[model samples]
Target: MVGNPDEPHCVSHLHPETAMDQIIPFDPERMIWGSAPALIYLEIAVRVGVIWIWTIVLLRWVGGRSISQMSVVEFLLVIALGSAVGDPMFQADVPLLYGMLTILLVVLADKAVDHAFRYWTTAKRLVDGRPTEILREGHLSHAGLDKKGIGPTEVMEMLRRAGVRNLGQVEYAYMEPSGTVSTFLYDQPRPGLTIVPPLELRRLPAPDALSGACCTSCGLVRATADGTCAECGATEVTRAERLESREISSA
Candidate 1:
């Protein structure tokens, strides 16, 4: 027959076990329908139903960002849910209805929170919380930072990562629900290479400037103010200030 050569029936069964082979003979009662074939099938159906319903409901309530923004408690809940579902999925004795009920309870609880978040402003603010306004009108708000349990140093580090040296560069800044500090640059834009001002040499650092130049292999250019390159294990190697300066001047 013109059919799959690798099909189960297409392969020949070995005659018997050899001296080198270790075989565990199959029990027809255990391998085939077993004692609870009907229940086994029912378990499959229930697990599938729970998984399908929960997947959609969870996504709706938790939101797309939950995958990225899951907190410690949220992560533990996810792990527990997986374990709770596993027993019902594999065991034939466990009623599928019980498993489905558990899943439904979680889904209902999630939906309640989702509804509150959408309809009740106070409830939403209490649970989902609001983004911390870190900067306003180019000024860093110390009160905002303090409220979010973040320090000035951390804010500065975040700003530096956002390619901004001074607070004035940012028109607005907020600590996102995902724990990332989001920055909104002013009309001038943060002084860096961006899509609108592609290939701008203004931000290029001078050869003598420690922050601008980096090692070719490791890209560790910035060191301490004491003149030490800690990044690439090369203390003597300085930035290509002359090249950068020339390029910027020409630009």
Candidate 2:
């Protein structure tokens, strides 16, 4: 009662309201603004200013990828910020409908642009930009650099950072849609590669109808069977016959 209304203890409730009947007389209209109209206009202007400033700051900090890959929390933050400041931008009322409509229109325009980019290659190139191919088959293509607006010096810098001193080591290099560079390195190749794995080397049982067992490595399991592993490419018939004879004697 003795302190100013603008003071922390009076303005903000740090603790529960006292049980004592304290009569504090103050006029809300006089304290905040002289009139309701002035208060309303001030509130609206502040809201709009806050929204505009917050949007610019967030966009500058987060970058364009924020719009491309919006998470649930980020999306909600964008919505809440816009909603909180909408009234001040468009109307003097706290519940601003015009500001909301403007926001909705902007969102719709963004969606339309996104859709157009996806459907048309030209549009995609204009909005999202096309991926640049830096390297092809151990060679660096200058055309790719031209398209990406970069020079060989910059490309070399990137390569050095990637621990690659020469272009001969690269198999493929491409720029990603998110402005990230992807590279593939060349490696040695194996010979005589087949579609199926070599299972002939491992020994297994055979039907009783065959006269002799075959080499596990060559797939000569029995004389009557295919007489080939078909997988390993090994063809040793003597080992198969010897193993089969021993099994027959044991039986």
Model 2: per-residue Cα lDDT at residue 236: 46
Candidate 2's TM-score: 0.35
Task: Estimate candidate 1's alpha-carbon lDDT, on a 0 to 1 scale.
Answer: 0.51
lDDT by residue for model 2 (2-60), tens = 87867665545466665332323343443223244546555655665465446545543
Measured by lDDT, the strongest candidate is 1
Name the runs in model 2 displaced over 4 angstroms: 1-98, 160-165, 189-251
Q: Compared with the true structure, what per-residue lDDT tens digits does model 1 show for residues 115-198? A: 766788886555445677877655456567666666555666666666655443567888765566788866553222111121
Number of clashes found in candidate 1: 3
Whole-model lDDT per candidate = 0.51, 0.46
Q: What is the TM-score of each candidate against the true structure?
A: 0.41, 0.35
- Candidate 2 shows a clash count of 6
